[model samples]
Target: MIVSSFFPGRIRLRNEVFKDAEIYAALYAAVGNHPAVKKIERNERTGSVLLEYIPEKLPINKLLALQSDLLALGKLAEFYSAKNKPEILKKIKEIESKL
Candidate 1:
């Protein structure tokens, strides 16, 4: 039951469980014989876990703009303080006018 990966010296663990068709048959037989993990007789098929809410993809341009805005805010915060609110507001207004 050797499973090869692109990266060297890596063998997937599942290969040991389902190595070949013969192993799969043996596993099914063993599980069927065991009372603990007995086969279910369901009419409907079950599905894997899935995501309920999917988010919209953000554009690269918008992402870059957000990053730039964050950097500017960080720079402004470093300069501005509670005691110097008036000066900070004046500077921000001056910058806003330029923009």
Candidate 2:
């Protein structure tokens, strides 16, 4: 996790999985409703997220871990599976040629 910015009530973080819309949607759905979370914003082009939260309700390090680890592991698992499966590899190569 790369912390691009930090202040008392807000933090902006950068991570590779943050560029994935799927991850963004999941993160927003997972934490958007928490009382500590005041607001959340994302920039897909930069793979970055800006989170505004109440420190009294949620600690910053916990937020950082939750943001960086959960979906990243999912992406890593996806990469590992795709690399191991020959059937998926052929289809991926085929699609890559078309693109």
Please report the candidate that would top TM-score against the real structure.
2
Candidate 1 structure lDDT = 0.32
Q: How many backbone clashes does candidate 2 have?
A: 0
lDDT, each prediction: 0.32, 0.63
- Per-residue accuracy of model 1 over 1-99 as CA lDDT, tens digit each: 121221221112222223233323433443234333223121112211111111133233433554544345335445544564444344434333322
| Candidate 2 runs further than 4 Å off | 60-99
Q: For each predicted model, how many residue pairs clash, with residues at least 3 apart or on different chains?
A: 0, 0
Cα TM-score per model:
0.24, 0.58
What's the lDDT for candidate 2?
0.63
Screening candidate 2 with a backbone cut-off below 3 angstroms (N, C-alpha, C), the clashing residue pairs are: none
Q: Model 1: which ten-residue window has the lowest total lDDT?
A: 46-55
- Least well predicted 10-residue stretch by lDDT in candidate 2: 90-99
Per-residue alpha-carbon lDDT of candidate 2 for residues 37-92, written as tens digits (9 for 90 to 100) = 89999998988889898988877566565543534443443554334444333333
